[model samples]
Target: MMLHAGSWRELDTELYSLTDNNTHVSIVVPYTAPDTVFEAVQSDSIRARVDLLLLETPNMWQLNDLSLACNFPLTMTECYPNGTVTALAVKVESVRNLNPKYLTLSDRSCKPVFSNDRFAFFSFNLNSCGTTRTFFDNVMVYENEIAMHHSMGKHQSRKGLINPDYRHTVSCYYLVNDTETMAFRTRPRNSDPKADPGVGQLVVQMRLAQEVSYDLFYQTEDYPVVKYLQQPLYFEVELMRSTDPRIALVLENCWATLHEDRTTLPSWDLIVDRCENLDDRYIVFYPVVADARVHIPAHVKRFSVKMFTFTTDETVLKEQIFVHCDADLCDTTKPDGICSGQCASPLRNAKPLKPTGSRRGIAADISQHRLSSGPIILSDSSNFV
Candidate 1:
């Protein structure tokens, strides 16, 4: 669906890039094991799940499939042979903006119930190392707040991540409504000085991860810099594929920070037209060449696709699968599928409109794992035996 509401407003703002400190970060997705094992266990046995862990260190990163909820520790193997994570996935340098950074994550309850097509992305900070400051007020980042681990460690005396509270809302950001606007009513923080005094510096780090086919556009709320809803915005998009169907695409607004601040609204719009499934696709891998066929998720608002190559070797030939959202692939009948290139014409029935930047990726990498490891099921498997 296209949005066409007319000229847009611009907000004055500031942007800054954060430097990477060279540490590995891990994102763990847990799942259940298989039906075979369930047969041996009694009918009353508790269920177990599997964990798909994605680990990213400064120099290298890897994906591992581990079985959880089992009495025995099942060895988790490295999905990648060389243990090299695509640079695209690990090179996300943390950014620091003059404005306080916004931190947000998809709620646990919001996990895509369908095909894992929630356009999922999250922003966060890292404290892979122990702390290095000396004072109760030295904590810049909260246990789960958006503050940079670097900034927080700079103030505290005690070492190690001192998460005083984790139950509270860990993310210090808000989701922009579909109306295309974010209102930041900055009030004195809970740790503000004058009254509470010496609560350390409040620094937020910027990190964004989103699926392909969507363009995130930003404009301040205060300028005449109008955006025509009928035209597509310019952006730089990149994609990275893992051994599994889940891939990640990053969109960085190359536009310099505009100076206004009433309320800034950045928008992410689905740009691809539609799709037609031509073949049973496969993911290919080689030196630097990692590509996967992305399946059109059931609940995605928009779909788009781009191709990337890393190796000149033919071994990279179709080791993976991916979904494309180009115009040719997407038509009136298949509005959800995207082709690999830009659409030839505007979607005949759709128009572009202002959007509010928001949340959050893949399935091909999924099938490969299932095929290699046998079918995965978290529910009880005893009946099968």
Candidate 2:
């Protein structure tokens, strides 16, 4: 008998069966797991993962996904079916990790009434009620790993890393933190007058967990001129994995400081794209910032952004970290030429949209965090975090 649009599919134990328990079938799927998302979640740093399937289905139709038992049904309008593809993501990150009953679906936020006792690759099929076909040739599965530990500690302290003698062959000074913490800064505190009287100071707190197994992407020691993004922007960060399922890698208390007034950059929307684990050494992380703008309309020349990384009870969370360096190293005349090469950037290819100035960084007005204007058009003055 031909399975109609609303017909339920049987258990699939064959090759394309995405569920760990071989629960249901998702017909017309082109690629299997490793074939598509292998490299994405192949990092040891990734503890979980789910496929972000980009799909193009029949015009003005919804998906008839029968992978899970009681899947909260979903329908798509294909409103602008200009050959456009919608998404049908699965919560496979918790595949074998969680009880089958608690599985999640991209469409249904609440648990389904008839959940399959297994894990399924978020798959979409033709609706039994409708005759629209769902085609997914190109797909992507993003990995979202989180830090289960408390705040990652700072290995380099201003007092501990200072040297009296310093010299340089290339640039005068080096950046305190890498891209990992590029968007991090602390709020202005009246207590420390000498330590950056106002805002715009990137907190120099490096988390020393090299052995913790998380891949990081940062430009060379020579930092980018602090660019401002007048438009909203998003960033990615790899996080340490959590051993326990209940504890999610969560981020909290995030805001940006304007350069001119040292005020907070209001948040219109902060989205946590993923909080699951992938089987990769490093998880691909992305967050959505609908509006990365200030409450006021004034154009910002400089600013500092701030956010934190840690584990919490929330199902969806993101992470970020930053650190400060010893200002004493800036003198360029400190001790046994230690600060010279220590602060110099290696001879690598020129950075994208390299800053014209030879300044240390974009935040020149502030203390050691020498920031300069660059291409990304980021909000400015003294942006941190």
**Which has the greatest lDDT?**
2
Encode model 1's per-residue lDDT on 165-224: one tens digit a residue. Answer: 211123111222335667787677777466645643211111111222332323323222
lDDT of 2 by residue, 1-385 (tens): 0121123233233634343235443433332333222112211221222232222244524333222111223331122223322222222322222233333332233233443433222222222111233223443212211111211137534433323121101101123333563566789897856654674322222122111221232333423323233222233221222122221122211122222221222111111111111111121223222233322111111112222111124211132212211121122233333223222112233211211112122211112321211112233434534
Deviation in angstroms for 5 in model 2?
92
Candidate 2: TM-score?
0.15
Q: Where is model 2 more than 4 Å wrong at Cα? A: 1-216, 219-232, 259-385
- Give per-model TM-scores: 0.13, 0.15
lDDT score, residue 113, model 1? 18
True-structure lDDT of candidate 2:
0.24
After superposition, candidate 1 runs with Cα above 4 Å error: 1-236, 239-263, 266-352, 355-385
